[model samples]
Target: MVGDAHRAPETAAGRLGRRLLTGWAVLGFVYLFIPIAVIVGYSFNDPAGKFNIIWRRFTFDNWAHAFERGPLTEAMVRSLQIAGIAAIAATVLGGLVALALARYRFRGGALIEILLVLPLTTPEIVLGASLLSLFIDLDQQRGFWTIVIAHVLFCTSFVALTIKARIRGFDWTLEDAAMDLGAPPWRTFSRVTLPLIMPGILAAALLSFALSIDDFIITFFNAGTTETFPLRIFGASRNEISPQINVLATVVLLASVALLLAGVAARARVEGRPVVVLTDTDG
Candidate 1:
């Protein structure tokens, strides 16, 4: 009876702690998502003026005419084109770099690694300015190609690092095993190695795409006459803040969310078996 009495207070304290932690978690989520909530909520808002900040009423008019603005739609399409091209280029180049670094121990490996990190560590302003100067020196026009090249330059680092992190301590002997089983090197890589690392590659590609699409400073420096979605929004903010902007942004948010869900589902399906890797780092 006495022991039970003593344990009762400890149980109550534990419950109290759990409740506090749950409250804190709820508050943290609210803090993080409140702005997102506001954006979504305001997408449906019917404002009296050009600015959609102050909500007057709710209407589906915004959704009905979401893509009616030709300039805005064109800018969005431009951004998508850049993002697609940049993401593909970055993913291919970075995937090769990641594969080489993970598999081989060649000369100048340390230097290559350092170079990979430099773009990531450098400030966006500095990189953008450097790119601008390079283009000027080459007498190249600052337009779609320049923006794509600039995005690829910075996004490659992110893609490489993300894939490297994903494949760190990964077992490359699996390749040897497949080769020993009479599989050609290319076939072994395509059939066995590719499947395992595909998730990481997809993740890196998505990251690259997101970065390329959302880039402002670099694109700002490189874009001479071309206007991306972000640039269009900036222009709109100066003149008229349209509800269409919010509508498009919300659409992007939803697409991103859908992609995230699909990736998660694919990962779950692929990860049924445990990934075997070597943890030893000794040479």
Candidate 2:
């Protein structure tokens, strides 16, 4: 009877703890999603006031006239252009670095790896301030190019690290075999090696693009006359908040999600598997 009584209490305690944990998990997700939900919900709001924070009424006008905000649209276009250019530059440079580090062992390899990692570990504000100072010292004007440079500087490190991780376990023997089969280096790389590593490259490119687009601090320091979408939104929020901001933000979020899904689908198609392979053999 004593043992049964003790067991009953222990079972009750376990259930109570589990219920508490489940409640906390639910709350955590709600906390994380509440702001996003607000943003998405406000996109359809037809607000009488300039600020769209308050719920007025639901309308599809904002969605229909998404580009009605002149400066906002222009800024969004500029941000996209900058992100594309910066991501391409960063990916090209970083991919080369990743290939070298993954495929070759040489002097200064450890030092190079450490240097590559240093930028990632460094605080963003410090990096932004240093870059600002460097531009001043070099007599370079802060503008579109400056923002692009700043983006590439930070994005390159991430691209390198991600691609390196992706290709670390790659088999060089395949490349050797292709070469032995009378395929020139470029041909072999394009046909065999490139196809194999394309997924990693694409992932890194996407990451770099997203970072460049979302970057605030570095862009803020470097963007003198140039205005990006985020910068425009920040400026507008102080004076007048528009539902168009929410519309654009929601559109961007949707676009990003679509791209991510497309990437997953493409990877699945290419690999003939539901999930991507991290190593040679699937377990």
Candidate 3:
């Protein structure tokens, strides 16, 4: 009965409209996935000349030697490290900020909300320029830690907003009840508040990691003499575009998808919701 459509005798016009909407949805999905399809397809292709775009022959060599390029591999590893650290740092800080905003009335709460929105609305170029200037004023070297710090700066807003949306209208009475049952504050939080909010936190962490890994502009401005995966790809493109890029990208794409799906399944299990939302009705 959940998500059931209002079924009735349909006219030809109604049928035509439904068909049009379904076709439009299909078209949108195709448009979004076609580039990803091309990327996955190209990973198997051997370059005809300097171009990996040409489909000359298929081979497994690119997948086999995905980490063959030293600079690319190092850059990718660095990017992963930075993303992981930034994600954890952002998630913890953002979770606390979101909890504070959601759970308590405090001074400057509205101002804090506005400030959180500013980073998301601000242009990447402006953020990068401002951060670069700040770093120069502090005389801090732009490297791994700087990149991680910059990522955390931009990513915190995303994490906070995401978790805030998730925890909106959440029942805090459960936490209070647990505390009333003689649980310590830490225990109540770890057992009740944490489990309730963990899904949102995980989602935010994954999102922050993805954004940090994919970021080019902020990383580019802040990364002095260091190359992230995106930076490496851009640099390599100036020389030659390799199939290995596509291969590694496909791996990342699949891994991210897998993680998301796993999280969804786990959450569904924890919440006792249906694993699959869509259902078929029989006449």
Span of 10 residues, lowest total lDDT, candidate 1: 274-283
Candidate 1 C-alpha error for residue 108, in Å: 1.8
Clashing pairs in 2: none
**What pairs collide in candidate 1?**
none
What does candidate 2's lDDT look like per residue over 1-283, in tens digits?
4667556455788989999999999999999999999999999999988989889899999999998859999999999999999999999999999999999988888998899999889988889999999999999999999999999988899999999999998988888887887879997777778878888999999999999999988888889878998898887888889888999999999999999899889877887853323223322
| Candidate 3: 10-residue stretch with minimal lDDT | 274-283
Candidate 1 per-residue C-alpha lDDT over 1-283 given as tens digits, one digit per residue, 9 for 90 to 100: 4668556455788989999999999999999999898888999999999899898999999999988959999999999999999999999999999989887879998888899999988999999999999999999999999999999999899998899888888888898987887879887777778877888999999999999999999999999889999988887797788888889999999999998999889788778756632222233
Off-target runs (Cα >4 Å) in candidate 2 are: 1-12, 273-283
* Per-residue error (Å), model 2, residue 239: 0.6
- Model 3 bad stretches (over 4 Å): 1-11, 273-283
TM-score of each: 0.88, 0.89, 0.89
Q: On residues 1-283, what C-alpha lDDT tens digit does candidate 3 reach at each position?
A: 6645766778999999999999999999999999999999999999987668789998999998987858888899999999999999999999899999998878999999999999999999899999999999999999888899899998999999999999988888877777677779987777777767888898899999999999999999999989999999888787788898899999989998898789889877878953221131232
**For residue 111, what is the lDDT in candidate 3?**
96
Better of 1 and 3 by lDDT: 1
Q: In lDDT terms, how accurate is model 1?
A: 0.89
